[model samples]
Target: MRDRFLTGLIGYPIAHSAAPAMHEQAATALDAHCHYQLIEVAGAGRDDLRAMLEGVRRLGFAGVNVTFPYKEAVVDLLDELTPDARAIGAVNTIVVDGTRLVGHNTDATGFARAIAPLLATKSRGAIALIGAGGVGKAIAFALAGLGAGEIRIFDADAAKATELADQLQGGVAARSVATAVDGAAGLINATPVGMLPNRDTPVPDTLLHPAMWVADAVYSPLWTPLLSAANAKGATVLTGRDLAINAAADAFALFTGMTPPVAVMGNAFDAVMAARYSPSA
Candidate 1:
């Protein structure tokens, strides 16, 4: 028997999340009555969190996608953590089976899958990753797992970047801004610098080159200044929307326990982009 009425995403400031649209389209395609909603938990304290979990239990939601500040914070609240999530120290997807909430980290795997085809024919080279926060750490580990020749990290919080580097041991090198992009085959920005209302690129456009591949973890604007600069430089650009779609694919699988129709998910994502930037409905 097919499960009825499942899945949702939890986070603060979730008004912009594409999860509901993506999953709704998927559920529709699968002929499943599942519904996905955005549960805004901003300013929700510990008691509020408990109440929310209890409500999920009472409502029998199949799973929920967790994001941003709550990814780490929700770990302690979960009944169990998958090995991958435990290693990454973050969880972006959670499955509620019986009375147990199992946390899993799909961001790393999702990113690897999305970037693999792009790199399949190209030679692996050094990567300069900016931002050393949770998502940054996950991406760093994913890149290392992919066996990139070298990884360099830079962050305004030098110590935090260094800490991530140390965790990666010899796989990463901590570098200064001037030499950060030097000879790097790829550049990744995991910071919020280019997010909505903040149109600045974390790295200078002067540093971009045709030989480099640029990726930013900020997807809201879809066309971040960094991506624009990379494209102008003739570099291959990977936008955050790509990552979001890929991550949502993984989350969809976790929530439904079935392979998501990538084409359907892609269409839904494009629809979201259209609605978001469309001048008229």
Candidate 2:
């Protein structure tokens, strides 16, 4: 039996990541010996990523979670990919087995599980998805799988948006944020905007409406500027908490062949948030 496991997350600007607490707490609850690290490499290009992954392979690390700019880029570096990861054209978790590196996507599954309950009785109307990057692609695929009526995507990089739209049926690359959000029943901010140290919002406050539901992928601040604005407008809002906890649990399961207690993970997330948002914090 493996007595200890070394896993980590690879991405830049990961100082605000809440994954460690969630994974560590879940490990404690499951009696699993695990050490989750944060490997930050700023402005890492393809070759830089190749070297980092090689290090992960040579070091005997069990697995690592890929994030931000690398989620899509790391796909080509892996030895194998789960169908979902390949189909989604992105990956968030990579498991190292012997000499082979396998890529899997828990973000799509995690977002689906997190947002399904909220949209249970709601119509699968048009959705405005901000950011056509890796997380945006995962959210788009997840929403498509959930039977979304239509998905309008907007990214500053028009080519990226067009590329993703071309791959997904019923997806459109809108001209602007307004063009995408217009008449949409749901909205999601899948970008790094509105994260801690960045108070920016993907969409303008005036564009948000009471009839639509809003979701943001930024969890560190918990109540991001976008969610706070949507909340002020009486729109039903979903935080990144659910998605974070669910994704971490799924990734933990993949990293260690053990089921983590979601409740325990949630508690850890709550504790971290509480400390992060406290007056003195």
- Which has the greatest lDDT? 2
TM-score of 2: 0.97
Q: For each candidate, what TM-score against the reference?
A: 0.91, 0.97
CA RMSD (A), model 1: 2.0
lDDT of 2 by residue, 1-281 (tens): 56577899999889888898888878888777788899999999999999999999999888999999899999999999998999999999999989889999999999999999988956677889998888999998998888877889899998888888888856555558998998889999999999879999989999999999999988979899999999999999999999999999999888888877999999999998998899999
Error (Å) of candidate 2 at residue 14 is 0.8
Error of 1 at 178 (Å): 3.5
The CA lDDT of each predicted structure is 0.82, 0.90
Q: Which candidate number would show the highest TM-score if scored against the true structure?
A: 2
Model 2 misses residue 167 by how many Å?
A: 0.8
